[model samples]
Target: MRLSDGPVALRPLRMRDAQPWHDLRRENHTWLKPWEATRPVDETPEMSFANMVRRLRAEARAGRTMPFAITWSGTFIGQLTVSGITWGSLCGGHIGYWIDKGHAGRGVMPTAVALATDHALQTMGLHRVEICIRPENANSRRVVEKLGFREEGLRPAYLHIDGEWRDHLVYVITSEEIPGGLLNRWRATHGPLHA
Candidate 1:
């Protein structure tokens, strides 16, 4: 499935995206390093792009994840994924994303995130969606703030980022809170974008 509004779009990540994805990661190494998750030192080696795509696809098929490639003006720019979906009573998922440094502050990330969150709530039948942002990640925090997600609390050493565990500010929004939908709320609050 694909989700989009204005110039920002999110679609399933493809194997063909490997080269651009790798290049973007390389270019944004310094920009993204601090927020990127790191595996345990003793874990198995990192998987290749193809393997990663296969794994994500399998997860998507299992209804456990939604792996999407973020694009702006028809150009690939980043990635956003709604992962760790739980259905029993929780019926929620967590969102994680990264964008090229050049695309920051232009509303691209927020728009992409809003689209994904709305999809999770509406199409995926999820009740809640969570976004965990490192306390120091002002840009990411802004995305949630812009969407009016309530700050639940702080998670100490929540996830291993860069090289060590980091504290994250937990933000959450339930479907009932966004009855009009996240994209609609964003557009109403921020006005329509030219891009």
Candidate 2:
């Protein structure tokens, strides 16, 4: 499935995206490394791009994740995934995303996130969506703040990022809080001003 508004879009990541995806990651190594998750030192070797895509596709098919390519003007710019979905009483998921440095600060990430969160809440019938960002990631925090997600609290050593465990700020929004949908709320609050 694809979700879009104007120039920003979120579509399933395809095998064909491997090259562009690798190029973006390679180019943005310094820009993204600080915020990227790191595998445990003793974990198995990383999978190839093709295998990674296959795993992501399998997760999507199993209803455990939605892996999307963040696109702008018909070009792949990054990735956004709503993962760790829980059905029972929890009925919620967490969002994780990254954008190429060239696309930063243009409202692309926020728009992509809004679209994904809306899909999770409206179509998937999820109860809430959460985003955890390192305290140092001001750009990412701004995205959630712009969307009006409430700050829950700090999660000490939440996830291993870069080379060590990092403290993360938890932010969340519930389905009921965005009855009109996240995209609609975003547009109303941050859209172009009318004369």
Candidate 3:
């Protein structure tokens, strides 16, 4: 399923996107490296893009994840994933995303995130959605805060980032908190989503 708000859109990631994705990563290497996840020394080397896509696709098929390619004005700019989905007693999932540095501060990322969160909570019938951000990542933190996600707490050594374990501040929003929808709430304050 595709999710969108004006020019910002999230669609299923595909192998056909490898070239542009790699090019964007290469271009934004310096800008994104510090916030990007890295494998520990004990683990195997990073998987190839093809292999990574294959694995993510498998997870999507199993209903464990929704890996999406973020687009702005129909051009691929980044990625967003609704992962770690849980059902039954706990119907929830967390979101992770990144955007091309050129697209930063333009409201694209927030719109993409809101779209994904709405899809997870409204379309998929999930109860809650969370976004974990490095404490130092002011931009990322602002995205959720602007969307009205409450700051839950800090997670010590949450996930491996930039070759080291980094502390992340957890932000969460439950379906009951926004009966009118998060996107509507965000739009109410931010005006139009597109630049």
Candidate 4:
């Protein structure tokens, strides 16, 4: 699947994207390290980029996750995944993303998020979408804030990050919250996000 707004777009991650993806991650290591998820037990070894993408593709095929490679002006710059999806009585998923340090601001992440959230709720028939942000991550929090996601308290010691468990604030939005759709609301508030 692909979603775009001006220069920002999201597409299913592909194996051919390995080089750029690795290059960006290596270059932004310091900028992104603090927010990186780490394995606490080390029971399972870390996966290589190719292995990671293969596993994500398997999950995508199983309908458990939507792993997207974020692009700006058709250039790979980041990633966004709507994971932990559940069906039946509770149809929902949580989103996680990180962008290149150079594109940190300029409405790129917000537009990408809105596009993903809209696709999740509108096209995927999901009931709700959520994002969990580390309380100290003001940048990530700001993205959800700009999109008007409701603050739903905190998840203490939520997920392991930067080598330790971290507290995260839950932000959520349901289909009912944006009957007219999220991208429309984003455009209404922020205008076009070209360039």
Q: Estimate each model's TM-score.
A: 0.97, 0.96, 0.96, 0.98
Q: Which tens-of-lDDT digit does each residue in 15-76 have in candidate 4? A: 99999999999999999999999999989877888999999999999999999999999999
**Per-residue alpha-carbon lDDT of model 3 for 1-195, expressed as tens digits?**
787888988998888899999999999999999999987775787688899899999999898999999998889999999999999999999999999999999888888888888888988999989999999999899899888899999999999999899999999999999888888887889977653
78-124 per-residue lDDT for model 1 (tens digits):
99999999999999999999999999998888899889999999888
Q: What is the lDDT of residue 194 in candidate 3?
A: 54
Error of 1 at 50 (Å): 0.7
Question: How far does residue 33 in candidate 1 sit from its true spot (Å)?
Answer: 0.4
Query: lDDT tens string, model 2, 4-44?
Result: 88889899898999999999999999999999999759478
Best by TM-score: 4
Q: Scored by Cα lDDT, where does model 4 land?
A: 0.95
Ranking by lDDT: 4, 1, 2, 3
lDDT of 1: 0.92
RMSD of each: 1.0, 2.3, 1.1, 0.8
Candidate 4 colliding pairs? none
Report, for every candidate in turn, its global Cα lDDT versus the true structure: 0.92, 0.92, 0.91, 0.95
Model 4 lowest lDDT segment of ten: 41-50
Model 1 spans with C-alpha error above 4 angstroms: none
Model 1: how far residue 168 lies from native, Å = 1.0
Between candidates 1 and 3, the lDDT winner? 1
Q: Give the 10-residue window scoring lowest on summed lDDT in candidate 2.
A: 186-195
Clashing pairs in 2: none
Q: What is the model-wide C-alpha lDDT for candidate 2?
A: 0.92
